[model samples]
Target: MDRLKTLMDWFDVRLGVREILRSNLQGYLLPRHVNIWYSLGAVLLALFTLQFLSGILLLVYYLPAADKAFVSVERIMNAVPYGWLIRTLHMVGSNIIVAVLLLHLLSVLFMGAYKKPRELTWLSGFGLFNLSLILCLTGYLLPWSQLSFWATTVATDAAGAVPWIGEGLVTFLRGSPSVGAGTLGRFFALHVVAFPLLFLGLVGFHLFCVRRAGISVPPFGPSARPAGVGTTFQHEVHRDGIPFFPNYTVKELAVVMFVLAGLVAITVFAPALFLPPDALEPADPFTTPDHIKPEWYFLWAYQTLKIFPSKLMGLAAQGGAMTLLALLPFLDRGEERRPFHRPLFLTLYGLGILLLLGLSIWGHRS
Candidate 1:
């Protein structure tokens, strides 16, 4: 312990590492009312770390070529020691991160954590959410199986619904006329390189905004609410409150560890759910699979687009919803942060959740 302290002291003298840690973490304060929901963001970072590390390992053996991708994945599952665990975790972790991200977003909504002065934080987080979906979409095609091939073909086709540049957008996405070698190469580049870099940058800015704005106290806390919390505009800066380091970091790590345990269990025990038989079949553009669909995270949008009178209308609706979510802080300038006090926002939030759930179920059944 003394040697460790001496090493830290030596580094701190030159790098000021101890002061940086003190200012950013040990000295940072969060609301005493903060709960598990607030830690979801950290949980997201943890999952992203897991996804990144596992993905690198998978990339070691992963062949991004259309002809070899499926065979390489097969070899990973069959031949490489514990490669199945890493691959399954990577695949399943992607979906789980999306689910957890949605929960974090909705929890922020429920608690009004994205209210005034923290708009930048919300915007950055929403950007991360969108980029995460793109990452998943690009990664979906990496396996180059029949499922990914046809799915990519269908998904990229939707870009053609854009008015003037639709065709160009589709071509740019696939890097050619069809989902082939060019598409695989482009998607591989995006999944491994482009999107991850953007994600990391956005994540850095998001954390900065969060720290600068300070954690928002929930409107609906227990009877022992903080002063000036009910109704009216309240500043987010907390001084005489729980220290975020030891107090909240412990809680944050506990939740992340618990969720990771569940994720590993799902990956080990139920790989079949994520790794379907379609994933085993190599790409054969001539033979389209029966009733192909996207993974569950996208089912809501998929179903919505299908039920629309026209593809353009469906795309418009989905695009408009995302725009609204991005601009929510500006549109919702309500002074009251309490859920009960803001009936209209609550109603809209509830309806949106119900609509997404209904659409997802419809899409799954369809």
Candidate 2:
């Protein structure tokens, strides 16, 4: 009993549950200048938590092998009480989470929140974004459906385009000449164990940085703090800003709760429409699906990949696109944050998105 009490005390101290709840509930702090953009991170966090829980529930029934994988999923949909709902929610939540994270990133970039003291925060977030994308890509293959199978085949084949090591790398990834049972198993392990663990660690670091630094104040505002200059708790919380106790924390909690309730309600009541089951058939090395395409998020890349010439120049185009995505931070080193200030970059971004959407349409048709 004594040891139990000691452990409990340590937990309370580490979480600051008592202090945080007391302060937040009592109205000790409030957000003075936050907007909807500030809510995306919290919303995405809630979505991720839902995805994790639903995914755990799914693992209870999912089979990793080629023969059983599709049947197992069908059983979950038809036999398991709420399995279909959970699976649908998990899929929708994954996509929604990515969308919100992108919104948060764009908002932060435009707001100039990436300026000085918060660069690490932004960097950690960038890492989180990349990790989330990987999580999505890996998870997509777990269902082992026809769509997932061909999608992986097409994607891995693209990776093989990497210069000297392309063919060898592709061979290693597929574990054979094509997408087979081995590929499914490898992707399943990565989706379930590897990516989630990395994401969990990165999430901890991301939240810690957010709490320690607090949200970035908007530039050119009355409440704006100078770059590299963070105020003391006394000044920021008690004197100048809200205490973060009752005020801001309460709002954050309210937002989280509302999002969770909404997501769960939707999942339970109205699941997203899934593709036909025929699409889940084991991938055949000989025949390709008529509409061979990627998930919506990667439509742009797939389209870009399609446009590349079969010759050396095609390899260069594909390689350069991948490198650009990987090294965006380094490529655009300008300090200016406002969209108006970076007109050229903004124009390029718009044009790129447009081209991606167009290509996705064209690829889907072809």
Candidate 3:
């Protein structure tokens, strides 16, 4: 033990590993009132790590060709050792990460944690969310199954409705007038290469901003500190808050373990339950599925488009909603951070959540 400690001390002296950890994790002061809501960031990181590793493994066997993609997936499932588990985890992790990220966004918004100094943090997070969705869309097409192929067809066709530039966008996305091998290759490149790099860069910046700005204080709790008061808040936390290493890390670890265990249980017991046998079939461009739909994360938007009279109008509305969300930090120019304090904002946000849930359910049924 002494010899091992001596070796570690030697490396730490040379690499400053202990110093980096001290500055970033152990010495960091999180708001005492922060609860499980804050832990969603860690959970997201965990899911992303799983995705990164599983995706690399999947790429080893995946063939990005219209003729071979579906067959390759089958081979991965049946022939490759432990490939089924990795594929299942990747699929399940994609859905769960989106769900958790949405919840985290809502939590941050309701708490008004995006105000003032943390604007960039919110922006970076929003960027990450959108990139994750893009990653999902790109990966969805990788299996080249009926569900994936048809879903990509519908999605790109929708993109082609973007007024004057729509044609070019569709051509660029599909690499042809139709979904074929070119489209598969493009999406595969995006899913495995482009999106991951952007996501990682944004994640690094987001964490840097978080570390620099520190976690937002609870707006309603007794430990709440006023916004715009910088060093004073730090002083209070320094005096009153618990050490993040043992106190908060322990809670975060528990949450991570619980979520991981739940994910593993679901993946093991009913892997790919969400995907039907029809969806697993090879892509057939000639015959469209009777009732084709996107993944559940996009169902709300899909339902909204169905409800609207004009396709262009529906597309614009969806795009406009995302734009509004991205620009929320600048639009919501109030110092108030608590939901209870901002009644009008809270009401609107609540209604938006309700509408989203209602649309998702309607889309699922329709």
Ranking by lDDT: 1, 3, 2
Candidate 1's C-alpha lDDT?
0.88
How do the residues 1-366 of candidate 3 rate in per-residue lDDT, one tens digit apiece? 999889889989999878877866667778767778899999999989999999999989988888889999999989999989999999988988998999999999988988877889999999999999999999999888889999999889888778889999998989999999999999999899898999999999999888777777779875455575553324224546666898899999898888898789879997867677656789998988788889999999899889999778899899899999999989987777878878999899999999999999999999
Weakest 10 consecutive residues of candidate 2 by summed lDDT: 230-239
TM-score of candidate 1 against the unseen true structure: 0.94
Distance (Å) between predicted and true CA of 133, model 2? 1.9
Clashing pairs in 3: none
RMSD of each: 2.5, 4.6, 2.1
TM-score of each: 0.94, 0.80, 0.95
* Better-scoring candidate (lDDT), 2 or 3: 3
* Model 3 alpha-carbon drift over 4 Å, by segment: 223-225, 229-237
Clashing pairs in 2: 24-245, 24-246, 29-243, 29-247, 145-280, 146-279, 146-280
Off by over 4 Å in 2: 1-31, 220-239, 253-286, 310-349, 352-366
Q: Cα RMSD for candidate 2?
A: 4.6
Best-to-worst TM-score order: 3, 1, 2
How much lDDT does each candidate structure score? 0.88, 0.72, 0.87
